[model samples]
Target: MFQKVLIWFLLSAFFLTAWPVSAYLPSDPLYSEQSYLAYINIPQAWDIAQGAGVTVAILDSGVDINHPDLKFNIWKNSKEISGDGLDNDDNGYIDDTSGWDFVDSDNDPSPVASPEYSQLSISHGTALAGLIGSVANNGLGLAGIAFNSKIMPLRILQSDGEGLVETLVEAINYAVKNGADIINLSLVGFEYNVALENAVRQANQSGVLIVAAAGNAESDQSAKDLNIEPAYPACYGNNSGDNLVVAVSSLAVSGQKSAFSNYGADCIDLSALGEDISSLAYYNPAQGLNNYYSYNWYGTSFSTAIVSGVAALAKSKNLSLDASDLTILLKSGAENIDALNPDFKGKLGTGRIDALKVLNSSLPATGKLIKLNQSSAVYYLDSEKIRHLFPNQNIFFSWYNGTWKDQTVEIVSQEKFDSFKIGQNVIIRPGTKLVKFQNSGRLYAVSFNGLLHNADSLTLTELYGDYDSRVVTIQNSFESDYTRGEKLSGLTYPDGSLIQYDNSDKIWYLEAGQKRELTDDSLVLNGFRSEYIIKNVNSDFYYNIGRPIKNLESNIFTYFLTK
Candidate 1:
């Protein structure tokens, strides 16, 4: 039973998916600066790069191209004319003027009603797109992360928020071939598909970076841990020391690990703003694309978009920066948040992403990056004014999150800046215990996000004269697809809405009101062939649907199948 969380994070039983649309929902007119934008110093980055001249492909439940804030930033394939009935771009897809929609097998990639969410709730693509590259300074809705980057909307997941292994593979190839510099995958599942590995490899070869969510399930799926499952594509690492994908975790505005975020000492790259985020959402009846800055949009999926936008911004500053360069800049430049999470020292990826640090680094910097002595980081001077040395720098740490970045200050004995000398550990932030240094011969364990291997250590003169690993990523998201998914004990009704089971009371009742005993014995959470189903009674029809949908609930059924 693989449980999937929505990128938008609505967190309802029947709606294992995310995102919404209400005409009466309040809109933020002057969405000047989100708390996260200020936290990450995005305003400073805006002066350097807004991801101009870059193509960021959103492989999700299609983008609302008609959104007032997103229309200008949408990538228009000049080679193809809409509805011309011709393969205008000569790219296999016929008349793909804006982008291709793999689910509906059509050229239109507009946001649609997901069957899983009561046949009215829209998927997450539009909101995620707003975060990545919605139009800026247009005097409309909220400003996007990469305000000027061209957005290529590719719909691979079904509207119900599920995707197939084959569909994902084709989407990766499509994004790569269609000139996507970065791809955001906020969705995740426990299943491991070999085709995904191959697709990621191909994307890597094409110099396309895939930023994936570390997943919303709070399982501690670390690299060394054997009890839990690792998020796919995000955990897809090759032995060649080349990572084309970056796994991202979610963070609250308080700069602490979100309660819903998945953490691993070695399974994640870095975290970004995912809690109570504000962006643009799609409303039904075309209410001119309502802004969603007030309603909290939560998920690692949103964080993935943030990272992808940052990558695009980095690419803007230096076009030569590839996936590897993007990776390094993000990991190293992130604000060291290990101080915020003492219990999760090296496990919460590198740290929270900081736009100022990333852009200030002058990414694509040509030099052998320095490595921090994970066990022996110092403040360059001791309390008694002495130079310190720890020979066991290499033995103290292991590879987990992408990089371990510790800020170095010119050593001064008296300060509150969280500086340290040899054999010193302190409380840097609330609930965070950072071990700045340890003794020479102690068998200390360290975890890093980068791939661990043979190290030919080189000393550099950056950050307290400490040599650390060459930290790397720059940014991922996915939709909710729980149909064909197993019956978890505390799970919702299978494709049946308005009705739910109370495990505690052992009764089924209307979710809109109270619980009652089921009068119908056969009214079990009937997988695909629910009382709400009509067309397909056999298992074959359900399995081939790509994602699960309630055919009987409403006339609109969302299923992804390669045409």
Candidate 2:
């Protein structure tokens, strides 16, 4: 039945427009009630905010920008003139007053038939657009989740429902550059593209929220399948802070997972209504009568659009929300669907999105998008695998160029280097900023407040607490800035102190500059805090990378080795 409904969705992907080109307010609604808004409790949400002034970029087939319901809500590239056949804004697009169509490589992105037997071409985009932002309370067909948000139409897929990853990547880049606050992608592809992945990362860097479909499948898109090879862009990355992508699966009206909707804990972020959904539909009739029809749509695509609308509304209420804030905002406010999806469990994500709860929740807004310090960086284990997010972005290594490129966080030490040599798919991330001493040329870093203190030597067993303690690992060290990883016990260093290995008893020693008698019980080393940082690499790669150590020191850093 779900497949049958999905086929129904695809077959009518576009209702050929038979009505006047411009959409006008309708006298009657097709549904007995705006059940979705009532079902999703959007009225309560709207009491707080409508999606006013936010721009949602829709990268679908194309939209009926002239449709009466969407004409006013459609985004206009005010900088570029339309039909001039020129790239007026010098932004690589000419006359893209509305939006550009990548499939045809043209400026007029209105949906049209070309790929032969394809009803899934035009209407789908228009439907998605109306779902995101159709003029509301004007006696139109249906009120969208973010009825006041603006929709930027980027026609990446062809009329025949065919689109390439390359086109999608370009569309993402275009959306990021065009001042898009939120991007809605209702399509899906099987394979992952590196270029596309990087582009999505860049979008997050630019602070744009992304909403994508978990996809419709004949069978359940189980969490296992999704985690193994998740949907593209949607499953890009779901780490805390700086995450832009929110993957959504569909939930039936019964509050159960849709049989055809994909589900995954790692990728899928929210569950929304997908069954018997209603939105805009366009049809070009033989008689050329009224072409626009109020149609009830189904599938995850529509649900994805609905979620995007909710995000827009949230942003509308809280204007200071960055991409990361919006991402966390939607998730934190989600109504967990775990009890209903007991068989699927966390795969459905933080459950269905709650507009009212999200609006009422005390999630704070953020002005800064990119992190600026190592203390603000974070790491987590997804699928039992380590992932990282940092102020400087991900870890990077450059041998001669001295330019840092995006690199994954993998910790390694000099002792562990021989087993898995560098350049063998190794990504180096330092525990802290490693600063080079002015004269020694050696790089060292500290994780704590770097309070200058006289050295008080303690035992490896006493100083570290436990040898097998998990905090002893680099992963724990990075998270707590070596504060959790190390135990001064009662030892306090007024100056910045560090744990140095003695190599004799296989024990660790505390070294700050305190000239104490080197005893088996306690030992002290002589070194100033700002002189240098300690590093193992001696190559000519010009290894200079560090953040200010507050008022204690400037331009200090640390590095960790990992493959």
Candidate 3:
């Protein structure tokens, strides 16, 4: 027997509306009407992060891959070449350059156009995609919650908004194997299947977060108690005891649970805007509408998508965040809405989500400074997720500018603070200042990853014009701590040195014992600073330099220098 899947809420017909435009606001006409943006403090959250370098897999009907607002944000598979008719990546799928369409077992994941389903019903995934990651500030369409995140579309549901649990299991596994940081399941069913639960458990074990919709009430029937009639994957989280999934209910503009949203504190883990929401519309050729905007769409599906977008933002802010960390931070940062809805008190898990609060509750990313609440000790989390403490204020200041109270140091809870294992004490930042022993007057420059390079008198003048003020004295007992590298007598500079010659306008990256010129201008525009670049370098320094690197587009170099 086929289990009939429910789309979960009421949707209004496609319509056009206008709003007055102003400076500093999105030029998209619908942006003015999206009051939920301010309700969730999305602007404040964007101040911290715009969800870059994160991927959210949408397992829904299908997404319009060519939609103007979503095309640029679609996740691209770098390993597989398109139209090759072969599995280049050798991951069992052929020519899935963007994402797989499990419903049709094809490469294109766009919604299936059929006469069996209404246009409004088939447009489900595209609307959710818009809510999650439409291009922001592009003056074309409404902005998404995590505007910079990539959307990985995995088509599991069909045009009529119904699909098999077996297909969903395959999509979940595919999402995990393809590097999805978060999985969004906006469809709901009442049947409990073991295969689906196992897929969710496997995804959770792989550090991928799952966000699912709490089933909605029928028009003739009242909202059901999830504790008695629990939904499948949403209720699985309640039973897992580890918050393996984020089961979301719907909230109206009044901050109360939507009349159609399923309730019961046991299943619903969060709430978000689900009424009068607007997003991108599917292009239905049968209707000859050729439209691209939908207004007044209400559903637990959209609410789940909203939460998924915020989760993406949280993951982007701290790349080290696991599924458990995300669930904890989301719950801890939520604003309790029990006061607003007394009858539904405790029924709405953790009340409504606040994007800014969620980000504030998260730990800082690797290579940043962090401290535990109520403690003054600061630690630097490295790329390996190891925390290294600074022995003294002198040592701490050498690696950071300004003061500890600045945004450079993030305050985290005791649980988050203890997650990283303790490593060796933090060494001084490379290429910033020269160091000298207490007994020996000889000065040495710190290179990449703590290698000490001898800076002789002539080398000192060439590297730093004012060498006296840049030298930092260290205790004789600490002399053995540093690893001594090659002297500055060679034509090559230290590993972390930034050099620019008087004759060229090129900026060179010196790292990993090689010099590669950055070919992509956007990398420099993203975070590379000009102040750190050493200008008017001696011409002799360029003779033995490594060959220029072509098409260098990765942000690793920029992140290394900026951090």
Candidate 4:
């Protein structure tokens, strides 16, 4: 007879470098067991205000809908009927009461049973949700940054943690339409799709902030092979003035960048607590695992969720601020991480997000301020040429065939006019009158547009009006090709081209080559419907460089962000 080994768990302090396994044990749970709260500067985060009424939409594998910590915050689409097998809201989804599952063609987006990782391990989404907003100070499991905030759980990725572009787009659209204040996407891929970019732009335009994981591919420090780009969406820049997307990095106990975390000065925006962070695990009653309420994981994915939760807190306090302002606040509030390379400064953005700084600071009004560098008269252009200009003044210039055209103009005052030169920079004082110049001349203006890039060029005709407007034209070409607000139908594409559904009958196609369209019933073979449809398919090509793009089976268990 063998005496059973009685495992006696003990509790301990939650040290930055130390794993909080003991703290996670039910006996004497410590605040450090709540990774975000213990590691993150919470007193600072709360000064701004707990994420009160804001809603963060988690677009990942289906969350354990019945989790004790998450039941209260899960989004419920009251307008959409549940289990009736009918599209009640007329939004294409049928019975999407909680959320629609793109991996499986059913309304109940629960994790499936599997051997690789127990189906009970539908812990990824639940853990992510916990990071965003678990019941705080309730003397239950653990506390979340935005304990008061709500969660719109969108099941875009499957249990195996795989996702498709179509499902992602649909989830994004849903988040925007459903009033999600912040969107957390801990997924990453390489392929660039125009439709996806457009969808992100649309969401930002709608004032919803987006946060993504910076990826876990350890930084490439070799001088010859240094990697400057992190991952997609995180790498994509927003045309809107608002800073819509942020790429987050992880920090270790020694305050150094985690070895598995990815960092790009140009691509990454900020850093957050990610390594060995603890959060809720899915409940498994059958295994007598009710006591195992929390688990520790690492990756920028967790950091992204923390930032999203902070964004929710910000939104709850100030409902007027748009996505751009929120991004500025996060960037401006971050504390520098010592482990980061000096070369990454400013490039990695303002630094790691400081929750307390954002909560306590008095935010500026919604619009961004344009501060002309009064000390510097010469501004560097993309061509490496320097232009002499005055501070706080707007200018117009023309470019033809990629070369500066020799035509220019100087409108000194809003009420006064001056002769214009086509190629030279024109300086305009405040309240300047508008004048139209003939020929296809491009107009350039600099304004504090809340965009990362300050200056923009537009066509002369677009600026043709008595009153100066915020919207300026950058191109003056008069081709019959698609102009602004023009709609066409029935486009065709080649076999290998990637297609994105635009409407019932149209699709936006993209590839390395030129843009084309695919029509007829062939669209069905490629996977498209007049209405939104979700299905798991098989493809050899990786949807994302590191992950499989498509699923081979209906039931798959994948992880979202790997360490």
Candidate 5:
């Protein structure tokens, strides 16, 4: 009888034969664990997020809702029906009690038992879910950073860890609509699609915070060597909007970027824990384990989820903060990693997301201005100094001699002002001493000059900088004494042709063999060109002289010349 009972207990404990019992248990007290969380400052983060009521939405494979460590924190759609074969909430998903599974086209996303460990990778989704918001201080398993926050699992990817763009889009929409304060996207692909970009935009407009993995390709993802390249969503969404997206990188144990993680000056916005990370794994019924708890994988994907959880924590504290404002706060709260690498200073954003700093710091009403450049029009604040702007704020500026001129000359074509040459300017009212000021519902001083110009003919050098510094000039002009109003016809070059306009008519006419007229009016014939068109002329036209014209037509006419 004793032998029979022991056998029964063993059979019950080991749900599946393939589940590795040794890996699920915590490392021996005598041995130091080789995991990412072992090095992270979780205690500090806990102090801040313990009370914050943040809710993170994980859009991956479905989470194991019954997992002991995750059951208490899993978000449920109380309005939706469960297993009734009915769409009670009318949210388009049927019985999505926990989260929808796009791969199976059903709500039941329980992990399946597999003989091989590799075959059991579908457990990744559940593992990630546990890492983001597992029940904390339960004395059962490792604790997540934000232990008390809610975890909304939206399964979009399949068991193979691959998903379609359409499904991902739907998942994103659903997450935002379901009151997910922060959306975590741990999957990435090597495709650039407009549809996906629009989905991200829609999420942003809904004030949903999105954090994406920068991908695992080691080399610079932004390099031109990768043909037809561009990792989807993450690379495409960074800096796409103020509150839409943030691309994150991964830091290894040595404080260096992960070898498998992709990095680019323009692609990734920040770095976080990526290597040797520990998280929950699916229970392998084949190993006869009743519960699943394994931590053996590491990737930038996990880092992104942690950041998402932190963002959720912030949201719980201040529900009124917008996406942009929240992003600023998160970035500002990061702790600097390795004070020696100045090169990585701004490269890693404000630093790794620090939960305590974020929770304790005063919420600034001001927003941040990222990627500020001269091309950005400064109608309000024109100075080089950074200025804060509040919502619904307006910036006012006094008209200067070299400022406030129309940068675009033509209505249809894109003929822009030549920074090298003096262009048109406008004047302001009397006693309106040229003063540059920025307003975010309030006035603030900036680095712009307030000199009054004699006329609207402001030179690019004065307004911005040297014309040549803006873009390389390419010249494509055919000599002909064409009269004003007489459309210059039949001028074509290779696909990319740089044509300079010197006439006052502000129009370049294109005529094809007396059959078709292709006039390029108001030609600011500098910079790069991919296509060509003829339209009305304007004052902002420029001429380039040293570039190859991709497409050309034999018969061409020049309507006006400045000489």
Candidate 6:
């Protein structure tokens, strides 16, 4: 009798093996250990929306697209004919059937595994992808929050988890152009980058939501005050009501602020369970790449993925919801945990996210992309009931693929179009296409607020990692129509590109947008392999480079390692 009771308890209680009546309960072996799923109320949320018909762009270290739990949900570029060695989609990237790898500038976006690097750093993107959209209830490793959502793995960070702002900017544009409903940036940097800021702003304007980590605290420090020391992408629109970047911070299992989570009332827009999280594992040095599970991972990076998954749920429920609509719904549905963390009260954004609450809430009915009386003018009806016009065909095509007559755009009466107040005119989508004056020799990249930044040959190659094959030569009279921003001068090497002098033993880290020589030991410490470095470059390039950064002993090169 005792043995039977013990067997029954083991099977029915902990693992829930005996009962399969509950449709929500997953049979994955590791499902019981994924405590954060319950902490964020994902099981209940799943009943409403399983994240169908939504695409999430994971802009981090590349994901393991072949992972059994992830393979089915990996997004495919239907427009691009594979292995053709041509830009079939004409969207800058070639043969990006699954996703683009900005790190190596190739078609394969899978993480580059090396025996030299840490498994955690290399598997970062795969883990985040699993958290967002791994196959659910398949008796696999574990269920993802948005199991039915497709994942577009845009590899921005290298295998070591280090990446540059320029790469991030280009990736953001790619996500927006490729129809990513939500872009999950499970990465962070200490510096402010204008190109990255403009990229985020432009993506938000294009009806895509961006979710960024609020950065973890340094090794020797407590949680830093973001108000005093800001982190990029997350703090892009701080204190601005129009800010659409959903800056997510970290919370522990106890409902308290994770000691390492960067926080401030100004920057943090949401918080989620960052401690003791579980997800799929990719890098296994001993056994090689295999479908596996990992637990106890903690960071605002995972927290950001959590919120992004919830946002995916929201997007799946209401196909027309834009960035602003999702942000408002998330905030309104959050469960305030300030009472638990008295010291960090009001610093944790609206509060810990309640996925069920976010899903249950209704979005404003005014959201849509529409045209008037079969007229060529296209406008986006925003949450505030404002109609923002797409100034020209260039701007319209930048936001959408195919022609303007797609089913996504609603044909409304002129009176309905005029019902909403006119807001700002839509700007050309960034990083999708290049523009230039018809008679001018120079080429310019479009950014937020219609700002054009002049790009030279080196800027095109180093910053965008490609040449100008898709330049749109506009009429010279249109020059006055755009706001001119800064020019991309070749003062610094593209951020994160490796360089060495013609015959010098020294290697420089250009991630700071300037030349900073890496210590000989850093090569081994950070897993700087030979193939990744651009060797034998002329020494003359370093003539205008900035001095090496100070306090190298404390700074970790990557965010995943720091966390």
Question: How well is each residue in 1-563 modelled by candidate 3, as lDDT tens digits?
Answer: 54655576665656553333532456665677667788899989999998999999999888888888789999999999999799998999999999999989999898887668667767889889998898877767688999999999988888887888878899999998988999999888898888888888778756688999987887788887888898878888563344668899899988899998997888888799888888887765555647777788888888899899999999999888877668877777788999998988888889899999999984433355567757788876665667877755655665444454443554554655677888877666566567888899888888766689887888788666666766777777666668998787645666656677778877776766666675656324433445556677777665345756554233333222112
Candidate 2 lDDT, 183-218, residue by residue in tens: 998887667777878888777656678888887774
Backbone clash count, each prediction separately: 33, 52, 0, 36, 54, 0
What digit string (tens of lDDT, one per residue) describes model 1 on residues 215-243?
77534432222115676767787312445
Error of 4 at 98 (Å): 1.6
TM-score of 6: 0.63
TM-score for candidate 2: 0.64
RMSD in order of candidates: 27.4, 13.1, 17.4, 22.6, 18.0, 22.6
Q: By TM-score, is 3 or 4 better?
A: 3
User: Estimated TM-score per prediction?
Assistant: 0.59, 0.64, 0.65, 0.59, 0.58, 0.63
Q: What would the per-residue lDDT of candidate 5 be over residues 426-492, giving only the tens digit for each residue? A: 1221122211223212111111121222211133223322223222111112001111122111222
- lDDT assessment of candidate 3: 0.78
Off by over 4 Å in 4: 1-30, 115-121, 218-230, 238-242, 284-292, 338-340, 365-563
Candidate 3 to truth, TM: 0.65
After superposing candidate 5, which stretches have Cα over 4 Å from the reference?
1-38, 112-120, 218-229, 240-243, 284-291, 336-347, 367-563
Query: What's the lDDT for residue 226 in model 2?
Result: 79
**Cα RMSD for predicted model 1:** 27.4
Inter-residue clash pairs, candidate 3: none
lDDT of each: 0.57, 0.60, 0.78, 0.53, 0.50, 0.74
lDDT of 1 at 310: 89
